[model samples]
Target: MVSITSTASLANALRKTIVDTQNQMSKAQVEVSTGRVADLGLALGGGTAQDVSLGVRSADLSSITNSNAVIAARLSTTDTSLETIATTAQNFLETLVGAQSGAGSDAQAIQDNAVSGLKSLIGALDTSIGGVYLFGGVSTSTSPIADYFSDPPSASKDALDQAFVSAFGVTQSDDAVGSITQSQMQSYLEGGFSDLFSASGWTTSWSSASDRATSNRISLSQIADTSVSANDSAFRGIAAAYAMVADSGVTKLGSDAYNEVLRTATTTLSSAIGDLTRLRASVGVMQTNVSNANDSLTAQQNALASQIGALENVDPYEASTRLNNLTTQLETSYTLTGKIQQLTLTKYI
Candidate 1:
């Protein structure tokens, strides 16, 4: 036995054992450090397929959650714009009520405030993000609201001028406008002036928004309305209230005609205030839905991640213990190999 187990042969055997122990130590160290199996395919076997599937689902859920964050931001901005429009309308409504007495000091103030309100409305409706117009509905590329009082005479201003002249056969600033009767002014307001803010009219001049808003898939089985348009009736009513008061010859009208304009505009504004409130509420609901969907999606993602971890992860303590054992074994093999190589028949004799 001693002859057969020669110095060279015994050393070779220890060398092989050392190499195997080193390989095992390397793998164990990796598993301990990573908290996951170093060879998932080999460790999990047929279960690797399920691990891959779970990983894909978890990744998809995470992607959707990220996407919903963007959607939530857009909705938050939309809600803010809607609130601004509603507040503008409410302030204008209060101003209109205060000026109903038609005081001299109040007249210019009313016109000035109407001008400011129209500007506010236009600015809010024209709100954009990332080159996409939020109020453009699905027509995100275009500005939704036109500048009604543009100096060069926007399409809306030009259209208003034509409608006013056609209805009364006189320009708004003409002295003849002062001679206009209340009934005549009322008819004009109800007819042509009203038409100027109608859906078709607004589309032709004041707005380029589509009737249908943009929608996005928020989850695998759900979608959300991601935008609102300037063409909605609430926006139309608000614009009309401002236009009739600001542009429809208020500065040139007789007392009766002027009061008639105020009465009509105040009524429209009051109703529009309610509508604008409801519009904000609707957007709020969308915000809530997005939040809930994201919360649910995140929870699902965490659950899927846990399942994936169970399949791929290893016990770090167990791996660490195995690593220590292999290290000791490797060291012992090196020592044994060195000692065995030094053994010689001549030295023993």
Candidate 2:
């Protein structure tokens, strides 16, 4: 039998055309709605690699900027705590000076204030945020400062007693402290006593913090220091000043010896205040650097977004126009298929 045109075959062909046109219309609708290619592989092909690279870079920058935000907040809190510690030292220094001036201020009151200041200083240095201790340098889990005033005789307090006895041949509470000259007291204050507050001594007895400070990656090419240590020189100075005045048996010493101790402690406190100010200034510098890094990251992200859009985004207006044309073609195909279905021998007759 020779091949001949049939109404059923014609209808089947029209049905296939209508289905293909409808699928195209669906893709065009998606492109218009999303302003992106419905099929990235089909649209970008070889350029897809470039789009992927840009996307990955954008994501990395986003992660860095978010981490920068957290570090910046931590540094800000550190700065506030430093301000508090500095002010506490300043107040204690003022009280010590007034007492040394013989301005009717008593030694016991000064001692009480030193005790309070030291406690406050330790508390401030141990400040924590989000369960992480701030003053422990890169070691962020444990508290940075030890309470030497607490029971069981802290290591620092024990060291102070032993050093005093070795230098003067007696404990600080001995009546022989009254016989000691100002020169002898000054020597002890500047010699073995001073070593107790030295950096190495601070780490050994007073602090568990690391000398290695914490840093954060603020940008691809830049990092910023984000933490300060309780074992820093300034903190050591503060601790020394407070310990000598608060626990060095000032009540039993002669007038000259007592004055010498006050003089040395006051000097140490003053120097610590200056150093603390500078340390806070350093954190301020880190804050500025971190802010600048975030700005740069944002700019890079914006640039990456532009490049990615060029590669992957579609023009909504063009997509809409194409979709309308496809809609008309689909309607025409449906109408032709319906007419073909109606074409039968009885209807034609």
Candidate 3:
């Protein structure tokens, strides 16, 4: 009981076979040229889920890497600003020591240098980069310190002026100012002068910058604090030293009162230098954390990329060989279809 197949049915079946082989050849050629699978789902089949997961993970890691890069840049700027401040404090100390040692007898000249140094230190504390204040803590949009030389005079200057007037009841030029004792001057520094550097004084005199420091997510689980604020002890110490020298007035430079002020300033400046050095070391640790996180992310990204490549990437040589085989199969199918079509029922009878 052999069932005879219809010629039209056989022809239709051959045509479908030819179409399927042509599609395979086309896909192989594309893979050969692009070196990547045209369809991840089709190429990876059941393993597509793993490929998708890797893709998402890679994207997350890349974003973290970029964020860390920005943090690194900000930390670098902060480090530079702190270094500048430290250097300024060191130089001011040298100037103060030189004056106290009486190496140069021109009191007026020493006063001028002190004034200049104070202005420079203020400028450094107020440093900004890319429209963001490095020492402003979380208040990146505003300068952290006011210019001491502004036309109207900053609140810090006005406060010092009042303190001087109250202390001696006369200006620095009065001979009575020369009679002020060292202990009295020290009292002013530890009391009023020190007050000017206090948090309350800063709020009144300095710009209203935040006391909260900036931080960054350097890793998946870690957030690193990356900035030192202008409210830090080192900054306060330097500012107090400079303010004492600058606000004490020119007439008082050669007096016993001025020498006592200089001595206090030198001690404060020396302490500030040590504080800044320690702060810089802390910033260095932050820098290292960021760098290490960057490296770790990069390594993870590379590993994920390799996994995706294994699932989606095509071997060019293998694709080329497969394409040639499909091409031969397609040509043979066409030849056989032609031969079968020629064998009509009439020609066979």
Report, for every candidate in turn, its global Cα lDDT versus the true structure.
Answer: 0.86, 0.87, 0.80
Residues 1-349 of candidate 3: C-alpha lDDT, one tens digit per residue = 9999877788889899999998888788789888889777887889999999999989888888988878888888778877777777787788889878986636667667678877777777677777888788888898888887788977777777777778768766676666777788878778866887888787688646677888878777788887878888778788788777766664554367678887888898899888889889989999999999888898888999999888889988889989999889988989888987887879757
In the range 1-349, model 2's lDDT, one tens digit per residue, is 8989898889888888888888888889889988989988888899888888888989999999999988988988998999899988998898888888888467778888888999999999999999889999988999888777778888888888998998889887788877888898889889888998898888887888989889888998887687888888889999889988887778778898889989999899999988898898888998899989989998999999899899878988899999999989988888888888887899758
Instruction: Rank the candidate models, highest lDDT first.
Output: 2, 1, 3
Off by more than 4 A, model 3 = 1-34, 170-179, 322-349
Off by over 4 Å in 1: 1-26, 102-105, 330-349
Winner on TM-score between 1 and 3 is: 1
Please report, as a residue range, the 10-residue window in candidate 2 with the lowest summed lDDT: 102-111
Write down the worst ten-residue block by lDDT for model 1: 100-109
> Which candidate's TM-score is highest?
1
- The TM-score that candidate 1 achieves is 0.88
Clashing residue pairs in candidate 2 are: none
Predictions ranked by TM-score, top down?
Answer: 1, 2, 3
For model 1 the local lDDT of residue 167 reads: 86
